[model samples]
Target: MSPQLGNERRAADGVHSGESGRFTSPVRSSRLSPLAAPAFRYFFVGQVVNRVGSSMAGVALAFAVLDIDDSASALGWVIAASSVPMVVFMLLGGAIADRLPRAVVLRGCNLVQGVVQTATAVLVITGYAEIWHLVVLQAVAGTVFAVSYPAFLGMVPILLPVEERKAAFLLIGQATSAVGILGPAVSGVLVATAGPGWALAVDAATYLVAAGLLLLVRLPPGDRSNAKPSVIGDFLAGWAFARHLGWVIPAASASLVFNALVSGAINVLGPVIADDTIGSEGWGLARSGQAVGVFVAAFFLAKVTLRAPMRAIMIAFVVWCVPMLVLGTHVNVWVLSASFVVAGAALSLLDLAWNLLVQEKVPEEMLSRIMAIDGFFSFVATPIGQLAVGPLAIAFGAGRVQLGCFALAALVAAFALTRRRITDVRLTGGPPPQLTG
Candidate 1:
């Protein structure tokens, strides 16, 4: 039987030993934090592989568009095709995660992605690749991710102690940022030398590896077999809880706005900034600087516990905007890179704290669904931002758009943090939450 089903059976049989003590006790030692859990190790490794592969594939795909059609608009559509599916299906994906075994969902998704990427590689290799083909393939890949990511994220609580959720996400954020540092440079070299087809093939191989690692993981349990709800009902349940939470609702909405504006700039304008001001190599250096910041944050999170982690996260969220403001005004690659590094470090802090806050405060039964709702809405604005950035830049110039995004993001984050009670939430350091394991 799948691990999800197995976990459901365990929950039905009432396995709660060692849970209360780990959950309710005041967080004592940061020595054996949650990231050390066996299940998390497997999940983390798989995510690392998948992230690296996706980065390589993404770079290659953009190059492929340039090679095939040489039109910037065509490239934009191709890239946007991937994200559209996520906006459409992220909530539904979360519902599925709540209802299913997380491990099974992750493994199944990885397997399917392997097939899709492999097929994509073959089509490109055969010289039948077209812009439409890239769009269709990206949409398929995005659909799988919509389901996979929620399950992956929701699975973290099941594997680790609730108190460690922050550290765990810190670990993940750092790893992802590291990949961001390396993926582009690697992709550029691979595409330049081995061709985009080979890069896609490599992506397929990584998914296979991810699937294998996931198969080794043994999840504890979640409320997967609770009474099933209609998709709308499930989504509404999650939304209702999030909306009521003093901390989560506003934080999520503000983050949504911040991410929408910033991501669009990073995706569209960062490259322009690099190409126009510093050159393509400088772009890579700026990204690497950001990754370095993330790595530094992860090292701290892996070691120490901060009092009021969520408050720290909110502070970081505000701090993150400063770099964008600086970068908006700068022309030098070194200056842009330094700003990006600071922004990335701040982002790492935010990711760790935010994930920990929600995982600790929200009921585990609703986690996947809630995450889905959050993910869906949070990312919904990204494509809009991406779509608008080019036009905004064309009309007012890249500098103006970058400055506008920085100001808008800072305002949203500042407004969200102004809530008085938002700082009061924290993890109970007992055995763990009821549904965690």
Candidate 2:
């Protein structure tokens, strides 16, 4: 074939189709290498800022409840309130994200989130923040995430090349993990020093800043002229599309049960354990350890390529059982921290793989809707777990409850691996035909 034909074929496959190795436009080659494109830089910076605040809020909110109401179930109520709305509205969010310029949706959500967080901070600082008020407000805040998450998922594909998705995801993981490392500890200090109110105020400020940054980003218009008007129809359609796939369905099903059991158990139990044994500071330290592990894994996995997508996820998920077992056993703080570190690495790896896999396999137009469904499945049951676990711990032993949750998570994860697609599915990191003329 002639050189021109070769270049044309290569271009069709989404490779750098330039005659020379170097792409005249750095954006094409800059996928693996971050910050080459202006859009990515802005998005990355805004996201890191926003995530750090979110991470800090997680630790802060738990302690805030502890301050006013010492009941474990109270904390559970607060967490459940937020998550339920997030699950309920997620599909609506995803449908909107796919239909509009994602940046518009993202910016609007961030602005609203900033307002909500500010209100939360005011309530806390004034000593007027009741448990019911918090629960109500968090439900509002949850809707922000419901919409924004779908939009956020769709952003990178528009900004970066197909080949760089892994790198982009890993980089994002790294940034969030870095936030994980500092955000909790810093939040602890702030909660200890000024109050949880200040940490919340900080979160509010980040959202405002993120909203501003999002305005600076320009994106291609979305194709939504054919979208349906009914929310329920769109939601069911998302789930319908989700359920047929071999890899997607099982993974989501596993996540649904796992979140109900594991995530809620951890959220409610982890803080209670901290208060009981090592105190809040020790809990923060353990969280810091988990963050460290995540940060380290992000850097390492960013460079490492995986061939067998589902099997790698299964193997990593098996290790998640260890941390829960150790925590439930009441082993020392050092040991628990170590356990958290291991759990962090495995969880981060699993998350990276799952996200990259979605981006690689799903069509860009449908990515947000699918991701919304994925989010719905992944977290839908969390409120159930949160609501149940604390009470279960009160009834049964915390140790027993935690152990049971771990066993269930492991069993479901193991069952997920039993599917043929788990081992057989491969991520070639395909160079899908993606670049515009």
Candidate 3:
């Protein structure tokens, strides 16, 4: 997702206007308007296809690991293997993306991902797969993603102008939500019938297709005359810009805590609990329900106007604790699925608001690096959490661990709300206010 102005411009008063003194951008509310641009159209199709495959792979990977070794500890190690590399290489990836053509970098990374995923699929399909094989393959995949994601974040501005971004983001979210609904259900069927290997193979094919699509996306050449002397210098510049923002550090800290405790507990232990209770098919439906919620939120938010977007976003963070609470206390699949719907809506809203905030506030020249720094800080603790959660579950039990994680998440949300700089910001389609340090 990238977006550009389509026959519309902002007037001197900061309101989008046409020759008739009224807003004229259909991109604001019409779902298909952004697709008019050839660049966004190609990018959108590829992204949707890729997301569908990746979502299926997410479920398939979990079950495949459990099939190999049913221990939570084993699954934890495999997931951590991937995340650790992402944390280590994320800044470098961002610097590279900033220095290169984003589309070309993304195209190359997708090709690598296809190859790695193909190899992993073959190993699993041939009955010679080991946990180590998966750990190694996923680590390679993670490295590719760490390099590609900052390009992904910054690509939107390049493809589309600022006026159309909110709509483009919402449209992308809607498409992702729709595919997310299908991916896990289809993955469950594939995993149950043809096996996880086939599901992963499908994921591999999508990457190749995405790579092909990226070839069609023509972007303006990036200016390299002001390039940093070194990768470290590029990163230091991004950090310098980021460190002065009062909200950035606290938000990053909250993200670190949230992903570490809340997300770790869910990803490591949720499947184990689901396997023992609702089974894989039901687990897939539960995830689909979450996607449905995301779609609903995206649909609703696109139609409404927000007076205080950041404040609403903070409230949504509190709602994110609902899923852990439900998983901790409820054994029924429907109840778990329903709770996930609420949590998913909250997550979708928060994600959209946060992305818009960053894109609006950060300068285009430094956007990729800032996004990389944000990702680096946000995910630095994730591998540690993933690695530890399984053993903690083994010691304290999954239910207790989930409940404890939920409590901690709630505390983090509460602390975040007390920061006036985070809560006071508004998105009103004007020049970004100078944020207080």
Most lDDT-accurate candidate: 3
TM-scores, each model vs. reference: 0.84, 0.89, 0.91
Per-residue CA lDDT of candidate 2, range 127-217, in tens? 9999999999999988888999999988777666566567777788777788878788788788888999999999999999999998777
Tell me the deviation in Å of residue 155 in model 3.
Answer: 1.1
Model 3, 143-261: lDDT tens per residue?
98899989888877666556667778888888988999878888888888888999999999999999999888876565554667998877776777777756676677777877777
Query: Whole-model Cα lDDT per candidate?
Result: 0.70, 0.76, 0.79
Evaluate residue 86 in candidate 1 and report its C-alpha lDDT on the 0 to 100 scale: 81
In the range 1-437, model 1's lDDT, one tens digit per residue, is 11222343222111122433233223442533544455677788888898888767766765666668754456667767777898799988988887767889999999999998998898787888998998898889889889997888777766654455556677677777788788766766777677778888889999999999998776555545543457676677666766766666655666677667766676656665555566444555565666778877687766655557657776787667665565578777677778767877887877776676667666666777778777877788777776777677778877778788877876765665677666676655433233322
Report the candidate with higher TM-score, 1 versus 3.
Answer: 3
What TM-score would candidate 1 get against the native? Answer: 0.84
Candidate 2: 10-residue stretch with minimal lDDT: 1-10
In model 2, the clashing pairs are none
Per-residue lDDT value at 163 in model 1: 50
> Number of clashes in every candidate structure?
12, 0, 5
Q: Rank the candidates by TM-score, best first.
A: 3, 2, 1
Which whole-number lDDT from 0 to 100 does residue 1 have in model 3?
A: 12
Runs of candidate 1 exceeding 4 Å displacement: 1-36, 69-72, 122-128, 195-197, 220-225, 276-279, 302-311, 318-327, 421-437
